[model samples]
Target: MIKVIIIGSGNVAQHLIAAFQDSQNLGSEIELVQVFSRQTTNLSHLLDYDKITDDWNTLAEADLYIIAVSDDAIADVSSQLPFKNRLVVHTSGSVSLNALDDNNRKGVFYPLQTFSKNKAVDFKTIPICLESENATDFQLLDKVAKAISDKVSAINSEQRKALHVAAVFVNNFVNHLYEIGSEICQEHQVPFEILKPLIAETADKIMVLTPEEAQTGPAKRNDTATIEAHEAFLSNENYLTIYKTLTQSIQHNGKKL
Candidate 1:
């Protein structure tokens, strides 16, 4: 079995711990040897107390060490590792492969999806982006990625950076819009639940149709009257700015905003 150790107990780290444990339960050739977290309470529910470590000196040897901490902490965490030459990787979409300390073999095992501690995700459907300096380490990363996900891709630093930007647009930014819509609904005494179907259908349509082909709105029709009404109705300057910006982009046929 390929022995693995994970560092951190944040959202990404917890999700990874669950996915790896699930894979092991299914008889996959992978074993989660241990996990390192500053506060054991954060992960005590997910893993046995014996398997979670708070001290760096007690870290066991493993074939792979996954640093799933925040982006800023990756280098510091890597530098503090007790071992060397092991395949050490970070679960960051924007951070470079070289962010890890030079004492270890660096790689990236970035899962391209937003993670929330309360939200369960199917790793099988999430795309895992792998990057490494050498072919041998990349092969190992690929195997580990495929062990959990059906969609695995060899993404280099530059491409991964671009993908992260696009992900922010599609996932993070879009979610903000949803939050705005929800707030608007609540403010107007409209049930936010009523918009759930529309949201579902909009998301489902993109699965088979191109985003451009699926696009529909007053903006798409260049309905200036509706656009003006929406802009006028939105008393919040931030909302009004975003509405006008998006409308202009749509009317301009996907012009960069």
Candidate 2:
């Protein structure tokens, strides 16, 4: 059995712990033996106290140690680990594998998704991106990933970095635009719920059609009059700027296509 210990008690860590525990329950060869948290209480909801540790010294030996800490803390945390020559990895898309301390074998185990502590996600559908210097370690990571996820890829650090930036544009930036839309609705006394179906259809469309093909807006059609009207309707200087910027971007992209 491949024993694994995860460090950190944040969103990604909690989700992974749940996924690994579920795998263990289903008799998968991978076992989640322990979790390291600076405060044991942080992970109490997920695992028994015995399996969670606040002290690093008490960490049990495991075949793999997954560091799920914030990007800034990864190097420091890995440097502090008491053991050496073991397989260690971080779940970061932008951070390079070399950022990990060389005391242990290095790898990346990035799960490309937006995670909130309140929302539960199905691990089987989450694509896991992995990188490692050692082919043997890569195989072990692949096995571990396959135990929970149906989609897994061997991604190098450079490629992973590019993927992360694209993710921010698609997930983070797009979500902010949704917030703007909701704000616009609230300002006009319109129910934000009215836009839910449109939001769902917009997301579902990309599954079948390319984003460019799915595009259907005044900007896409170069309807200059409607675009100017939308810009004029936005009294908020920031929103108005954003509207003009996005409209121009859409028109530029359409022109290129």
lDDT of each: 0.92, 0.94
Clashing pairs for model 1 are none
Q: Candidate 1 residues 1-257, lDDT tens each? A: 88899999999999999999999999999899999999889998999999999999899889899999999999999999987788999999989998889999999999999888778999999999998889999988888888899999999999999999999999999899999999999989999999999999999999999998898889988888998999999999899999989888888874543
Candidate 2 segments exceeding 4 Å error: none
Q: Clashes in model 2: which pairs?
A: none
lDDT of 2 by residue, 10-99 (tens): 999999999999989999999999999987788888899999988888999999999999999999999999999999999999888999
Question: Using Cα atoms with residue i matched to residue i, what is each candidate's TM-score against the true structure?
Answer: 0.96, 0.98
Query: Largest lDDT belongs to which candidate?
Result: 2
For candidate 2, give the lDDT.
0.94
